[model samples]
Target chain A: MGRIRLTLCVDDSHADDLGDIAGAARRAGMTVEQELSGIGVLTGSIDADNLDALRAIAGVTSVEQERDVTLPPPGSPVQ
Target chain B: MARKSRKRPAKKQAALETLSVSPPEQPQAGGSAPATAPGTTGRFLVLFDRSAAPQAPNTLRRVANLSLASAADFEDGIVEPEGLGGADAVMLPDLAIAIASAPPEQTHALGVASDTGILAIEPERVVYTSGQGWPLNTGPAASADDMAPLDYLRGYRDAVNEVYDRLTGQHDAEAELGAEAVTAFDEADATWGLQATRVVSSQHSGRGIRVAVLDTGVDSGHPDFAGRAVTGASFVQGESVQDGHGHGTHCIGTACGPERPGILPRYGVAHEADIFAGKVLSNRGSGTDGGILAGIQWGVSNKCAIISMSLGAPVQVGQSFSQVYEHAARRALMQGSLIIAAAGNDSRRPARVAPVSHPANCPSVMAVAAIDERFAVARFSNGGLNPQGGQVDIAGPGVDVRSSWPRPTLYNTISGTSMATPHVAGIAALYAQADSTFRGRVLMSMLTQYARRLRAPARDVGAGLVQAL
Candidate 1:
């Protein structure tokens, strides 16, 4: 099992960076999917070549693994 | 005006039944003299057993110009001071109040007061008379139209205006959420919690986000929804696309109700967006995947920027079709539609119950859990610690929240991730509206980053609880 990072876009200029990230991921032997611009949902294998490539890309403001999504604990009733 | 024993019944019984948590601290000087300062006449008359008073903090407190009376101070959340004892004999009587519906205990008291014809209820609402029929006696309720005396015109004006002021300060709740929903402090944000209904009036009110309320139909005639363009269709036969169950109304209300407290710049989200209501279930709240599928198709085709699904289908355990659902969610994402789904209410199990529901279990969509102000997951919100790690995207306010309902009225509150789902959808809309270039990755990323996570952290909480920008 492997982990993929997610990034998002705030403007159109971020579009090209999306392609770059996907290309880097492709080179690294991993899958890169674009939900939109800086926000790309990554999954599958981590390609060695793409690892250093995408991280170096500009405008990649933030990155987090998909599985780390925060969830609330159970039964917080607010009456 | 002796206590007319023959005029009505329950007066004496009701008076004797009046109980207080504790004796008024002042013990004297009652008469609307303020709860803290106390007047000679209105000292509390404890009717219940002396030890029966609740030991919580006393209701006696003198704030800056007014003494606040906690709603909790009353037995039924209402205080009827004059009726606590013989209307004439009660000392320093300030105001006597009772619900217009007259709960059994209150009914007896009013019935007795009616003997002296002292009971004067407003035409359609509650009216508190001083002792008997004298409306102007308390000075707060006396209508200006009643010509009693000229010398006290200012007092009468102040009293009636007090009532009138309350009625006039309607706050112009833009989305027709009514007076109950005053623009309040968004305790979550630590600022005024922007009115939920005000989401309707804005430049990009969900224009990019296509929200599908997958529940009962919605009230098209709602004032917040009035004049706004929306497409209507129903899976329920003969159910003319109106909010019958009221669930959808609330979900949609929170996502994007209407706008107020703005132009002056108040806190609100998602001003540009259009809603596509998916009436998958019948008005009675039951439906199969067929209607749901149709609703989803509608959302997909209409190019909704975001689709909010608050309902769930009970799928059996061990049965899995994760691939197919994931594929559809993937397709929705590719189509530029951000799908925000409720994590589902299955608090009984910490693990995602199976056979998991469709749509929500889909990988491409963002699954949301419900949380309270303290950032705890709601009892009903489904939890997950993903085989991958955190499964939920982020949490939103799913607690007791007021939102839209089907008419004769427009807004109220109900709890469920169903209520929570649209809140995320609205924020997504806000993101998309603010920046059209915002696609799935950017949108979800922003949401996850800004979300306030809970103790369950990676397990019960998803990306974390969502915090407003």
Candidate 2:
């Protein structure tokens, strides 16, 4: 599995909402690896494949996946 | 959706069976308790880290790195080639192999050798084990035929333990542990006696602890649990409060079964524990990790003390899936909820697949294994950390164990430590209750440290048998 990146952008007014939003995002499936201290950039993988759902959270303005994910099928032979 | 009402919160009751305060109306035949026979403990191939010293092909090793073969506290490992005839613990191979060439006598021998544990073998050879003589037609579930007599015997033994507990009255300390139970404990029979008695009930009965049982809903009305279950919901779309699969019902009943019958602990280890019964798994017992993770979050938000996940996250051993229970567990624990998950019951004969999957292995969660009535590890209890690291934690009764279900069926017998987890959760709750000051992690530590080491040690039987308060 490759490390797929998730990028979330929020409006300045709702900027303080990032922590709670990040917490919810973490629950929804994104891992917060590196945070952009000032401007507010959250990067993590969408392991649960619910990046779109993460975008639906109240404060999330926009969400983007920075890399392609190679998800394996069920019961495939172990490599 | 809605939780069902089952029993009272009183400590003298069984989830189903009533207490015989007076002589029982039926006066069932008083049979002598079953004798605990010495099981076959032998030698199997236990792999050693051999970091500084490379070893031979077939040798037994201790569970801990610093634990040498001479140490009594060390968990023993077994080797297979010489036959597990005299072995107490067998080393598990990374995978499970179906040994077709294994003689029937050998199977019977292995079955009889309670001390002799089964080590898992690799999968390729499982299908490759010469098909001439073995009866691997069905998995362990089908092997029920091979173990039916023993299963019945397990029921017999459990009944005997119940009877013995009754005659002694000096059983479960967790029973009716009211105000006096806290400060004025009777010190004589203080040792946690096995059986439904709450030796460690209040001390561990998850009191005030809210656990989100992501299985079948609770019996909203069981008196044993008056107001015990605060909230309930479902995910199977149309499934109501009814425990259609019976598995979830049995699970919740045990996880938080009221203590009136005197068998299970009565007070809330998590007695006042709130539950969010999310039925992600249908009546047949299956679900998506998405639903489970959602339930995990719900429990976390409600600030559940722990999340009892009596389900398995699938596996091919090395196979990795997006549904990693680790991350969810991490988040849950981060949010103040400890996750207790079941090790899968899929491994069968030779080298099969490793039974543990994502969730249990996730950090800080307790991954429990099933132990049988004999107190030897359940033949199917999944392994961990082999030579001693895999996926097991402490073990509880998972064979022929009777617990609550929905209205009609009332009670049923379930196997698998999935049936075993709530026992640990229950024990944890009890430990929490005994002294409210106890930290969840500390409580877990005390329980594990004091776990009665079983004779039949295996990766599956981690930390041996779990004890009551």
Candidate 3:
């Protein structure tokens, strides 16, 4: 709808470039929240429309929306 | 607060039908075994600059000269950082390098060292075990006279004998099965076969290993774990550490149940493994992604070896995996915690097979499929519909699985990929105990490598049925 939290995965080679990553996120109209160095991942908030542009950034491996994960309850039929 | 035992109201008794293990007629005993000490080696696995190690041998020697004895043990731990801080540490040799510290401290040190070429620094993380603050909810308590030193000795002897049974696979298999067990050749006693005889018999109990089960809460009152240690936390907003729902108790029972089950059909796997119950899902058996991720992070930060999640929401036939969960799983693996999740139970009999669910579909998370006693893939288990990662990674006994339930109902038999996921988690714990090297991705590889491949399609069963030892 408006803005949603997105997890942006970075290529191993470009993982340490915080300035470049921040610039790319800003250009894509996203605000970076956290940078996970050990696994080369960045968490940020971005509009749904800018998702495609964020994915196209250099060294960006993938950009996926963070969504709620709910477990199937007991007695729910599999079929 | 003093933990109180729970009693099922008398009105609910008529509705309870699940078979329960009658209390053993054996003598009452309460001897406590001395707690085993934790491992010492993985405390500080600091990675330094290998290229620089040779060129700047003097720097290495100077750093090794620190008073701490542990620093000298890592003589060969070094690697080159691809980026950041390489120039800083290399240019300023006078700056102190922290080899081992807590996570927050190590992160600061790594940030500084990365720019100077120190490569990487890994701090030892704390892993929590269960059976701590939360006491049994509704189980019997022995008086001081009943817990005499002689009784405690008898209990110790009994524990040793049970360990011997686990090693030799010697037990009253037929009598334990009771009257309800399928007698003909059509079915093997799941209690003896699926997790017990075939898996646990080959290895010692998963003692000293830290296992985290992220699911609906567990029955803190289950009598089967009278003196067992279980540390638990609830991520569900309004719930406490107690398992209001029975699913978590059932799953935990299979993964870390006692070898000498007070009831019939000893269905547990890694009996002695330290159980860390993280209640990600609520008593209603449902939860959001944030809670689940928080639970995963808790397990990783604690350095739990195996995190079993018998939970998942269905996905479309060709949806991409969640990058966030995938990254969480990857990071957990790096921290030596392997996560095993349930594939969706959405398949249609004789017609369609649903895709694996969200987090489970992630490449980094192991997706477990459900199988019945006949060694056939359960009709409801999801199939690998996506060409890439949304596929079943392994199979486990799920159909009509009998395990512990919330008191005073005591036990129940339910079927789903949920039941199957714990089997893999329990077996993973056994593998971890059998070989010290089995942890993280290596443990995962060993599980599928040793699995007993079935006749089902690869998409349905991944590598095959998970094996122990």
Candidate 4:
């Protein structure tokens, strides 16, 4: 399957070592985009087939497909 | 141990005699028993600053020239009436309250000497049971020869009638006042939302509190925000903090706009709150989870007490909340920041009601639903249909909400869960400022606890309408 953006939640055990989690995630065929250390989250893109590999990483908890939020156009009465 | 009945002083006895003999029809103010009042003991109750409780006895002695018996000296902290003896006051150290038998003038002097740690001084009122019988023995026992059986029965009848009349009269007055009050709030002095939420009467202006509104950026140049402290940042690539879309400015206006706007009808809440505008959503009002995550990180790093996200993606009925977002929210709470988001406007009401949206569906994040001026849940507001984490936390006035918008369109009236989110956020800032320790999860609990419970279901209005302190 083609590549899709994803958000990886880092487990509490690895919150202090986000760098290791990031390195592990990258080695598991995922491209790291942003490491939000404050919230213990890592956002990146990974092939649909390699999702399990990223999930199997020691510090990673759950892997979610990135969702886009779109609001109604400015002229709409209900925002 | 048997408790002994203490004898009333001659001065107090005379005061009580005058109060009891006063006419029932006498006006509460300027009545014959003005000094003791109709339903009050002759004693004055003084509340002292907690830190100054130890000095209360000294302060009372100096201000009112009265010696006080300390409750701490008594066994089990119970200050028996007989133990007071000739002392003019008894101090309950734990509550920092002093029950003193002082003249009105002396109590007035104590009130005026506020710096001496006296916070308030008021006459202690006699409270009666609303039930069938009296619970307190407030006065000396009456001797059998003092009254005939028929006269005693007549006295009891009169006392019961008096209490019933007073209770019913007060109830009628409250009902009349409620009926005369504005049935529906409009934009006369303040927005309907502000009046409905009781923000108009709130004394806390969110002074010195930092609130982060992560949406489109805010219109920093808006005249309503002149001289206000505003910090803006853009997480969206190549986009400046200036709001090209008016949604961010509108949300910010509701959350942190000035107390007195150039235009009529005060619309904003948390008037004095410092604004931290984070542009997670772009000028077109679209944003990715990554950008939103960045905004959360920024808000947490800056120590914002409240981070409001009025944007969210609709979720399917059975979908679970994002674990990443949930973790982020928990981390923010640990860092003393609360994340509040919209419950989405995907519902068509009686026809179809949508589940709370993503991110907001996270249990740690507070999901806000919208209510109209009539206190009815907005037709478009979502419900907590999904299990585990999709519950709505609180509701806010949303429909026809008037607030500041980008210049050229200086103000706009909008309706959405989007509009409602900031009202809660602004009120959260007020709570934060009201107590420095009220942060993160505590602030969320307070909002839900003090929320005015609506007649609607909890699924629609959660803990009900969010209220100000």
Candidate 5:
């Protein structure tokens, strides 16, 4: 299965324990990238087949595919 | 004064009650009624001094023998007209105003009761709109009635012109010179966006407030921002906070450049605001959700009052917003930080309109649309096309916007919803500085509430163009 980068939102109840949620996510077949404790979010990569496993982790409210943003070239008139 | 009862007959009371409950009656077109004088309902509007509002009911009873149904007596202060049975007046305690139908003598008595706190008494008038004028008789027209339609058309045209004049401050003698009134903004001394948003006349300078611009980065070495306190951090990996791409510098320039620049025409908004430049995107103008979220976390941790993001990836139609972003936005608001983002510039206009881009599509994040100097929605500016969590919050001047750019190119003029996002961010800083209490969700609401209403649809302009304090 292909690996997909994702952003996981921690539940409010587990917001103070982002470290524990990150640990849980790691055990559920995810490569932890960043732990954004201020906003209770974790970014990582996981196998497509193991998506349900990551979602099923305790304190993980949502697991969304990361979206990329690109602006127009500097020389472009409309930015 | 002695209280004397002047009870109305039961039949007359019922008629008055019906009149109060029913919509205002439309006068016949070209009727005998004088055109200059406004049509009045039999009821009078009574104004009371604020300090005297609480005693209004008792005062009215003592002075004019008029009993009042106080709005405060009802739940949530919602006074139902039909529920105001047998009362001579309905008193709105909060507004210190009253609507009443009383005899001329009683009204005179209330007006003269200075000790009782009555301010003024005036008759309520019948209001009409340009779209729905006094009902015109569409039946067979007589030859003499041909002039009537012409007259009505002239009146409608004048009403529209008058409203436009008031909105754009075109009533001044200088603006009476034809074309200038239509395009009221002149960038002789300041950028057209600043003039259009009333930033030129604003007194607040965003002093003591921290504004975070999460984009590529900012040019700290720029001459315009020489002595300004700018704190910067890079969330993008393998890149320094120094803005290699011009996008971040331009945004920072618009939001917190300088009071007096080396070049002519002021472009920045909050000159005194401390700048927190968070580089979330790479020098190539690209970034992932993780970098953006990290930037947000950094801004929130620093207690930045305003976080402006002029970058977003366009979402497809019927696509729901990211729950992760929405939750983060809510958390930011809870901590007294407002997240503002561009509503995207993927639309072609007059052909196809696109939905607001994400993270902006998140409900908690304010989605700012772009308008031109003429206050028309930009062709590239996205609209709130989706039903779920994709509403445009407000608008700002974006087209032909002049602001700071990287060195060797000190200034640049561009057009996009990207340019508009900083206008809002800058103005929000001014508002935050004006009153320290205005932060997070309250600041967001105030921005919309105080925006100048435009003739455009709410989907295109939201609450209209964002204005300064």
Candidate 6:
């Protein structure tokens, strides 16, 4: 499986333990990129095959894939 | 005045009979006031037990009366008189509650109300509205009859000449948007959304508030903003703050343009607001997550009251929300800044209702939908039912909307939730200006409460069209 960027939502109660919780991703061969401390979310890339194991980790609420965003192109039927 | 011993009407009785009362939840923290601040003579809304009789309405009112008789705000001060009269109490049987004036001594009030099987007590919200011709300004003076007729004509000529000279000088600095538009602009009322929201009549111009527009930068040199207070920075590497794409300029114009443009119709709202243009997207209207996140951090750190982003990428159906952006938005809100983003124009309405886009799909960010002049959902405006996170929060004028643009094309007509998002942002600025107490969640509540309820479904126009003042 290929590496994929993902966003993880951690339970707010366990937000203070993000450093320890992030070890789970490292064990699963994921590279944690950004730690959004305010909202209790972390963004990183992980092997697609390890996604299931990542979800089972404690304190992890949700895992969503990071995707690209863009503006509405010119003459792209905005109306 | 005595309490009127009126019977519960059949309709009200039926509603109260089915309403259930849940246990009290933890009150919101972070400087949020208690549900009922003690000793204040403000109204309190008390919830009753679901299985309680329809007559429980009176029971809740009585609880408030007893609680008010011993409130703390005035306990050791004045000996005020009071009666929980008919006019002082209002019952909403459908919601199984009654709102009555009281001194909000929570310990006493909650204990009394709970005895009557009450669920919770909340302060009656104060609805804010920008009254007609609010922030009133002096109108044009009339000519005196005693003055010579020629003098009156001269006076009028001088006034017109002065205004004309100023307008020409401004417009000449930049190319005219269009000759036809110039003729129509002066005669035009506020853009449809502004008119619908009553922003045109509002006197609160978002003065002293900083509004950050994070998008494809803005034309800082635009004539409409010749003397306006604007600050900007570019997050996109190798790019300047100048807007090559017109999207940022148009969005900025709608959210914080001048009250009266040199030659165009009044298209802007929040006219006096300070503009903070953050270039998150590249000139090509594209940017990565890092750039946008940086922009968000910048806006919040500067203590902006409102952050408007008329940009986003599509989110697939059934896709989960971006936790990263959600946290960023929550942090912004906690810091007293509101982030409003476009709900995405990916829908092919009457065919497919696409989900709201990323960043906007996050709960903390207010997602704005697009409505046309007819008040119908625009063909491209996304709908609710994403099943996870993306949902429309409010609607704004989007179709065939005219606003400022990049140079050489000083104006343009476009449509999308992008156009609508700025409308909400601008109205938010007005709300922020009208009341110093309004910020973060309270500001959001004021917007929804004062919104003009539209005929569309909640999925189409969450709380309906956002109102001004």
User: Each prediction's TM-score against the native?
Assistant: 0.47, 0.49, 0.59, 0.77, 0.74, 0.62
Q: List, residue by residue over B82-152, the lDDT tens digit for candidate 6.
A: 53432545455556665555333422344444457777765444332535322221223321211344554
lDDT of 2 by residue, B116-174 (tens): 23342111111123444433334333322235446556669966875788698855522
For candidate 2, the TM-score of chain A alone versus the native chain A is 0.68
The lDDT per prediction is: 0.50, 0.51, 0.68, 0.84, 0.84, 0.73
Output the number of the TM-score-best candidate.
Answer: 4
TM-score ranking of the models: 4, 5, 6, 3, 2, 1
Native contacts matched by each model: 0.00, 0.00, 0.35, 0.89, 0.80, 0.45
Candidate 5 local distance difference test against the native: 0.84
Model 3, span B196-261: residue lDDT tens: 227645557888888899988788779887788898998878889788778899899988887777
* Model 1 residue B425 distance off true place after TM-score fit, in angstroms: 0.7
Clashes of 4: 0
State, as a TM-score between 0 and 1, how close model 1 is to the true structure: 0.47
| Candidate 4 to native Cα RMSD, angstroms | 9.2
- lDDT by residue (B1-469, candidate 5, tens digit) is 2333444333333443333332223453444222112245556788999999988888888788887887777788887644455677889877999887565457667765568777777765555566665545444432232245567687699668868988987754322211122466667689988888899999999999999999999999999999999999999889999999999999999998787888978999999999999999999999999999999999999999999999999999999999999999999999999999999999887577899999899999999999876677888889998766698999998889899999989999999999999999999999999998899999999999999887567897789889999
Per-model tally of clashing residue pairs: 69, 92, 23, 0, 0, 3
**DockQ per candidate, 2 decimals:** 0.04, 0.05, 0.20, 0.81, 0.81, 0.28
lDDT of 2 at B415: 70
Question: What's the residue-level lDDT of B401 in candidate 5?
Answer: 88
Residue B115 C-alpha lDDT in model 6: 55
Better model by DockQ: candidate 3 vs candidate 4: 4
Among all windows of 10 consecutive residues in model 1 chain B, the one with the lowest summed lDDT is B56-65
